[model samples]
Target: MAERVNRLNDLTPREWIRFQKSWFIHNPPPREPGVLVHPGKFPEGLAREFIEFFTKRGQSVLDPMAGTGSALVAAVRSGRQALGIELNPDFARLAEQRVQAERLALGDQAPQARVHVADARQLDQLELPPVDYCLTSPPYWDMLRQPGFETQRQRREDGLPTTYSDDPRDLANIADYARFLDELVAIYVKLHACLRPGAYLTVVVKNVKKGKRMYPLAWDLGRRLGETYLLKDERLWLQDNVRLAPYGMFNAWVSNTHHHYCLNFRRE
Candidate 1:
């Protein structure tokens, strides 16, 4: 009899089964001072686990909204090629520098990671290599500019970026909620051409709260992008380390939301 082949990833049965759990608590370490300029960034540690699970070594990974190259660095560290598209020039430059530093530390045999300073909507024109996986996250529909500027007050005082950018092209700057959802979905729809068949894309996001209104950003992305890619299961990424805030105090019911939706999809 022939032996079974694992077509998806190079993980062992034990490791694969472990990842099958729907929820995980991953509290990442503090960020380096250089990358702190960007207001939001998913940890490289979190990105690596997903990248390793979805792809084999040497396969290529793409991060459309690559903030400071977290996903790119993770890809390189996991022995895979990395491609990042960052709209902000300052963040893009920093991402490239981080990637280069990672490569130098890993030596010549390490996989290469590249950061392109351009709008992700035009990724098709970039002529990037076929990607085996994508790991990214979108802004929570201009929540940075919402009523609670308090979330960003510290970053502002420290002279860091309060939001993604002042560029009107940035999705985080789009004021209308419906338009924001459409624009976000459009980027993924265009991404279908660049992916190989059976490629997996993981979007790390959360719902947004504007005063009393709730914007289901994660659910909206899953539903809209389902038209372009196969909608797969999602994992809950729970963070337990952050200090809880009194969102509603005594007036209303509001819990300190500490979980993000790691929505998974496949390009079939």
Candidate 2:
């Protein structure tokens, strides 16, 4: 039998217990004006929690789908080296600017944060070091393109793009759910090559809703990726701050889904 080593070098027993809880509340800070252009940005505070738990100081963390550098910033703030690859040139530059600001603020002690402009599908082509941990949030399928979403409507009115990028390479732009999942899973499979042995990969995602049908995106990813890596468990991220609207009122039963699955996997 192979020996099982403890991976929780940086976390205390109490902290481990806290993270083990099935669900927790995380209301992200108001999106900074600069990053508001990326409609699906995750919270830096949330990213920090995962980074700190999974890695020790000076270890490297990677975000393959870094949108405006939330994961990179969080990794640096948590005293870990950071790398992010963004597909959109505009978003990649914005992420670089944000990382630069973070480094400047940290002065001499700032950990390295590098944001690369590249397609996540071509992760192997990039010169990346073996990462200790990965924390990222992929786009929730093609939900950004749906016209009925209030957030999408607001972004469209503000002259921002409703989708991630106009480029066809952007996974969010894929209209077909199955094709999107295949491409996304392929990206993760490539990402698995970059992780050190026993390292953790945390993906923050939510099941998507299009028209009247609900797609089990998070569940599907968990099932597919589980074949490649050990499915450790999942933590639910509940959002209490967002204003809830009646998604399907009167005729059908549609509850507001205010939670996201923080799927954790380990490379064995």
Candidate 3:
């Protein structure tokens, strides 16, 4: 008989059961001023959790929309090879610097981390090995351009960009929502070719709110990508640390959305 293979998460049965819960909380650590410049930055700790759950040590991980290198840093710290692609040169440089710093702190034994200054739409053209897993967070459709967001106003006051980048190619800059979603989905479809069979892909995203209209970005992507890959399940990442604001209060009900959907998919 063939030798039984070991295919399991790097967690005990009890620990794995805990992670299987539908929802969990993750209040990110306070970001330094330098890293805080990015408008939308996920936590490295959160990325590490997903990386460790999906990939084994020394496996390759890819983040096509690597913002500030959070996923890459998590991969390196987890002793996995990582590659990141970013469209903005400044953010790509910052990601590279952060990855280098992480490598230095991790000593010479850690696996490699590389950040490429390129568009995620052109992922197929890049020379990358078949990745064991992919984790990324795409832009939430042009909502940053709306003036009603107080956080965006505050960022503008602080001399930081309210949107991701000025590049016309940036999906976040696309005004039409349908066009943006189509393009973004196309990019993911292109990336599908680079994943090893049975590898998992995780997309951390939230629905968008624009002028009292809710766009179901997460649900939309889930349905769209389901056509190509097996839609595994969704894990909620809740944030209780954000202060509550009375949005549309006394006029209409608007809950402060403090969670993101971690959409999981498997390459069949």
Kindly report which residue pairs in candidate 3 clash with one another: none
- TM-score order of candidates, best first? 1, 3, 2
Model 2: per-residue Cα lDDT at residue 22 = 88
All candidates' TM-scores?
Answer: 0.97, 0.95, 0.96
- TM-score of model 1 relative to the true fold? 0.97
Off by over 4 Å in 2: 1-7
Which residue pairs collide, candidate 2?
none
Off by over 4 Å in 1: 147-149
Q: lDDT per residue, candidate 1, 1-268, as tens digits? A: 9978999889999999999999999997988999998888999999999998999999999999998999999999889999999999999999999988889889979887889999988998999989999999988889888656565887777888788899999999999999999988999999988999999999999988887877899998989888889999899999999888887798899878889999999998
Could you tell me how far off, in angstroms, the CA of residue 215 lies in candidate 1 after the best superposition? 0.5
Cα lDDT of model 2 by residue, 135-210, tens digit: 9999999888888888888877899877788889999889999999999999999999999999999999999888
Off by over 4 Å in 3: 1-5
Query: In model 3, what lDDT does residue 131 have?
Result: 96
How many clashes in candidate 1? 0
Minimal lDDT window, size 10, model 2: 3-12
Clashes in model 1: which pairs?
none
Model 3 agreement with the true structure over 72-100: per-residue lDDT tens digits: 99999999998999998989999999999
